[model samples]
Target: MVFTAKEFLQLRETLQIAVVKCSERCLYQSTKWAAELLNSLPPLSVADIASSQNTPGTYVHPAFAPNNDPIEAALEAKELGQYLLAKSFFDCKEFDRCAAVFLPESLLAGLLAPPNDASSPVPGDKGKATASSSSHEVTLPVLSQKSLFLALYAKVISGEKRKDEESEMIMGPQDLGTITNKQLLVVSRFLKRWFDERGSGAGESSASQGFLEYLYGMVLAKEKNDEEALSYLKESVQLFPWNWGAWLEMTNLISRVEQLNIVTPKLPQNIMSFIFHAHTAVNLYQQGQDLAMSINDLISVFPTSSFILTCKALLNYHSKDLMAAEQDFSNILALHPHRLDALDHYSNILYVLNLRPKLAFLAHLCSSIDKFRPESCVVIGNYYSLLSSHEKAVQYFRRALTLDRSCLSAWTLMGHEYVELKNTHAAIESYRRAVDVNRRDYRAWYGLGQTYEVLEMHAYALWYYKKAAGLRPWDGKMWQAVGSCLQKMGRDRDGIKALKRALLADSYYDTSASSFGSTGPVDRMTQMDPEVLLQIASMYDRLEEEDEAKAYMELCVAQEDGGAANAEAGVGGGGGTILGDSVAIHADSPGAGSDGEAGEGAERAVGNEGTGVTVATSKARMWLAKYSMRMEDYETATRLATELCQDGVEVEEAKALIREARSRMEPVNMMES
Candidate 1:
């Protein structure tokens, strides 16, 4: 298994403290633990070993016995001598020759009496059997039993070229007596110097000192009889508070204590502590460098937190591990199957993961919950919409509105679906409902307007478009819709007005410059506005008043480019060109129009009530008079232009238009004669 590194380090630290403590506590109880801790290392003695080599309270140097091995008492007597030798060698001090003369006696027996002499070759009476020994007659040097034993062991293992004990280097010292104050001071001096001068790792050792001591109480060091193997660590930390390496050791030790304090306990305490731990874990998890451990522990401890699961799932999702994130979300579902937030989030996850099958699954789930929660119906509707199932999408949308009349999004989408299905009337109704549900919804109003425009109901379409525009006046499309509907109703002037508004709101868009609506296949309609202008031009053209038709068509042409071009002469500098151009109008001709196409609107165009007559309308009246001339009605043509010259009336082009009108009237009536 791939281990999370941070978690592994934490586990290792905790394990070290635990195993160390176990070794310490079981040292004297189980031989295995003790052997593991001590490794059969020796101890130092405060007094001498004796003639009863291995016997207690007997003073005999172990090496000074009459034979190779000695009685128990002799071994105990020499214990302090072995320790002193070890201390002197490790301390780099000279050995005492007087102590060496007794041979194994001083080496083995320093308790009852001091060695007679050092390096004297003799078999002395001290080797004689002495049955009684007095405690008061003995004095031993002071040494830390810990350091003394270690120093002796160091010599034993040093592989030095020693002549007498070459083959006996593996022997272990048996009865190292109590530690002396001087030896302890020597060990302490070494420890203090190492810690004080070492790198900042000392602080960690200090922090962990108490904890280490606690564990040491149970098991000695792996090297010797003492519990701790690391002597310099605690001293270092004590000497340096900022020693992080040592501090880390301490933290590890503390963590192990904490972990073991409860981990192996019965369920009741563990569970209670777990609950409390989980409370703090979440915050710490995000605090940097603490995530993996936090996650592992929390999930193991408090596996039921839906909120945590969700947050974790989101983290995974954002991390680009969809499979893992999906698993978390699924687990969350198991715990909170009816979670609305989960449903929404899960659907989105599916969308991103491109899990088509799961999309359907989410759609079904949302659909099933439609009755219980109206909002879910909207989700189902959108899902179907995404699937391109407009019919079903619309069905669910309507169903959602049925469940809750205030379902604004459902109403809005239902309208859109209807539009997709080409049911403009139904679409308009749905859009209207959406707007009613939320009057602030400009989109629904816009939809309603566009649908009406599609249905060819320009006036009603214009009404809705205007309302939507009012809501979001800055919206380019809304303004575009208004202009389109107005233009469709044959009000190009108003269309231009609305389209300009669109451009002003959003200068970067093309909505304003683009045409308002379809004008069929008529080239004339491209430029024609002031609908009366087109009507008059057509009337004159059909009456064979070509010159008048030509002049009026030019004005219509100018108006088509921009309705602003066709304004009255003094009205805001709008000077419409007077000359008309020949237009290829594919729509109905004059006769077709004289029927219902030209109704009240046409009559209003030619009526004599207004002074500023449209160019096309004015031409239409004069053309009617000219047409009468073909039937020999000169009097009627004359009455049409009573202020013009009386002469030949030709019908050709621009000049012909003026020529004809002059012939149809008396010159003297021109200026109100």
Candidate 2:
């Protein structure tokens, strides 16, 4: 295929679009084709095209002219061609071929040579040339530095693949851990030599040094030397802020908000830094106006970027705004259907919403695209989980972990499935592994609490629940778990405190979407979980706070009634609650009430058994009747007991309460007579 200059420009624009959209497959195919095209072009044509394009960091020698010097033009063409080919190979996962293109034979030989051999040639000297007529030495092209970084990265990845192969042969398929220093020693030594030579006033530019720094930091990070890796990554970002790769490396090293706050001021205040902050904040689940502002700013700068949209979707997911997250991810997939990143999250949203058809379709689509991907496996697992196929879900989740041991969602979801299957021990192990991979994962900690609670270990459950609550202070579920554990441990006052926090958290989350300008069809009032109120009321009753307990029980009944009325009036549908309005709660469903609301506390019962909201409400009425009798309000007590009997909930208890109330009323009547 032949391309005019205009066509070449169009191709470059296409590549840029692919990159901004985060379409790796598109970028890979384009680069591969472009490399082949450049290789077929004549030396002069290649030189003319390369010089004409405004590629950043591309250096053209002042003394060289394509029209005047055929030799110089050929050398430039060869350099550019090699770099393009290596990048294509890297994108295609042909890491060995990619590295071999940029790394000289001597360096490749030294990779296998003894570590003590000081006779190995430095990597930076590969493309250096001495001009025959001039005293000035020609430095390697700026692309050479990028080529070197790519070569080192390729080698590291190749080594990992070799390790995986060896591990499979030795121990069968299992979780492959982090890359060791021994495996990365070759690349580490090469980068050290490059930096040493550059530090000694070698002709390498700051940009070249930054690339080398990023490579070294990446190697160190893989080798689990995070402290040293962080320093190199920070320097790499400072030296070359345009290298988004380095910014990503820096983001990976800082997991905590405290660490991020300390590092933010030190980074260059540029577009890349803003992006880094936003990305890291999302991963850390640090929600605030600043994260929102950063995402909006990035959207303005890259309006067509699916990557930015994905980030926004992630923020919504972390904030528990399932409706907004669903919309954002839907928009992203509409624009770039081939995107595989975050599909696991999208599937999760569908599962929570009970959009079974959509979740199933997504799983089928992802499977068709690439079934081996961890994300795809997670999606499939969610699909099976939604169908109540716990074993099938576990199988797929295991496959996902086998593909990538650090897959946070895989571990967490597998734990959930194990819990569903009553395999509490397996669930604990999965959750533990998830926390080991990423301590910031509240879901894993929450799962651990649930598992311990199942085993009736209130002390251990409280500890794990507190850890989860600390990570997600605004998550009502975590706070509720903590409160439940405390109450079980006979700590009534502390349980009350935790339950109050849970109520506050729930209120904040229920209204959070409106604050974020979400015009989704959610009715914030109807989104309130009646179970939280019930739990608080029950706790107060246990504490002997008659007035407080009665007030809370009345509040729970009122809210449940209001929610039911709203549902009947069609005031909300497909919005507000995490389950959305579309999913009807069937009476036979283990955890749902007659009013179509799942009782959150009841749903947490062991063996998938649940006490419906109707039953809970009746119990509240029964207690209220008893309270009225004790307070000498016989008429009120009799009325409440009769209502409970009519409702047919707690019939035996209601009837007994009625007889007691009537007997007490007879004594009061006789006294009045």
Candidate 3:
């Protein structure tokens, strides 16, 4: 093997070409041959153009240069060679023999290596360690190859491999890639495991601490092999008490499976994971999806858990698997009836779906929670209301209000009870108290308005009604109230517009069976005024003159008193017989008949609600005659003129009455007939 420099150059060229081809098939494998060929080049330094031609996902092709431009990389290569040679023949310093030409340890490690055989020393081997001790007999300066391999392997096994080699190899610092924390951890751990496992000492392999297995589990989890991942994680935790990552990743993995509806048998080793699965199932059910599978999963995984059983019951309720949901709810109640969330949710479902009697069942539950959780009282109170059990509803609502004075809903519900019991004044007071607590409480405002309307306090009703409408514009019933109250108050245009909006917004009858509907109940409001007049007059006429007092004044008065004179005068003159009955019958009487209109032109003596324009005009004439006799005093004229003003007739006459009445204290003046 006496090779000339030209011969060395030719051999290196041939090896580099072979290495470039071999890199395609194997990276380290090709690098092994390339290093040997570069070793043959035998120069002070060669251009070790270690470029990697990478094509997208393919491996990088190797090139090299030991030139000055890459002196640092070249030095790292040299350091790597020196380290390897020292390991193989440490005491003899055999790597110095090859110092004129060599590669760094890391670069050489990255260099493709030939396949291991019986001849190549194992990457981590006890067999090569003593080769260093044997080399101590050799002389210094020129080193042997065997010495180099021994020293390098010692550095590798000890984790004392110089990091500066990697630093030096990167040029311009821009291409300096860092070993990420995770990667460094892997390398350090891998080396430690290898050295410890392969130590010459026989008992070194036995130990309880085993991070490697946990790392392997992480590998399985990353690969998404759930069963294998769980297996490795279990083994890791069993072998090592402090491998927190393994336990955490396993719990997280199990939790996620439970999320995807994948059921599993409970893991006896992991109580937290078992409970987490049940919780996950419950959450999914609440999201509007069918959670029957989740319930079944919980049942299978945690058959005896109270939390699991409780959730199953709720799922059953939603599925109308009523028996199951009820069973679950009952089980929960039996164990812990004071669970506010469970009790409230169960009661609400019952209330919304119109399940009444169950409220009493809830009432039983309420007593249990009331001592510890007073909010449950409200839940129980609602149960009583659901049954139209107004007395009990009132009882519970008042109890809840006592516990939570700021409970606007409790106050509102109490008011509703009053309304059901026909205690309008009491209802109004409760609603007003509720509104005082929450001025924005739309329900309270609405309830107050309804109570006032029933009590015939139109002005008060209108104010509360508008507040309710403003708070909840989407509540068509509120808008409908606005329309209805406005109509009654003679604000016709605004009322009609509000009513139309109510109709449009409340178009869907299924949701709100209110003022707007697809059915014939639509005409109810149009008939209100007539219906009211009829009922009122009937009650009044029953007592004759007393009927007027009952309806209009609510009490009898002396004739000299303000109300008594007006009642006796029969504003619609039937000789002091105001008919005190229906408006229709008043017209049939002399109020607007031929005799009433023509005879003495006395139709002017009709009541405020009597008949036609003809009757009204005739009454005005009589009033005119009275005006003349009274010497400019004109109560009769004013009354008749007011009627004429309302009918859109003789606008001038109506205006004159108002002006003349303002000018003189006596009633509106008439011409001296």
* Strongest candidate by lDDT: 2
Error of 3 at 223 (Å): 61
lDDT tens digits by residue: candidate 1, 49-126: 232235666644322334222332344355656644544544443222222322223433444232343333345545
What TM-score does prediction 2 earn?
Answer: 0.74
**Alpha carbon deviation, residue 174, candidate 3 (Å):** 84
lDDT tens per residue, model 2, 235-272:
98787554556677777777678999999999888655
Worst 10 residues of 3 by lDDT: 581-590
Comparing 1 and 2 on TM-score, the stronger one:
2
At residue 431, candidate 2 shows an lDDT of 84
Question: Considering TM-score, which of the candidate structures 1 and 3 is the better prediction for this target?
Answer: 3
The per-residue C-alpha lDDT of model 2 at residue 265 equals 96
Per-candidate TM-score against the hidden true structure: 0.26, 0.74, 0.28
**How do the residues 1-673 of candidate 3 rate in per-residue lDDT, one tens digit apiece?**
2444555444455456446433321223334534443442434343332222224365432334332234334434556655544434433434323222333444333322222412544557766645533433322222222222223223332232233323322112332333222223333333343434445564422332334455546555544566866775666556533323454556545533343344334233343344444454443323223344544553553344444566666554432233334446666666654455456556544454344567566767567655434357667766665656677867776666655555665667678777878877667777776766556556678887888888888889889888876754544456667777876776655664565455333322212222111122321111011122222333334435433423322111111111233334332212221211111111011111112222222211122222223432333333342343355655555665665577576667676875675556433333332
Predicted structure 3, TM vs. truth: 0.28
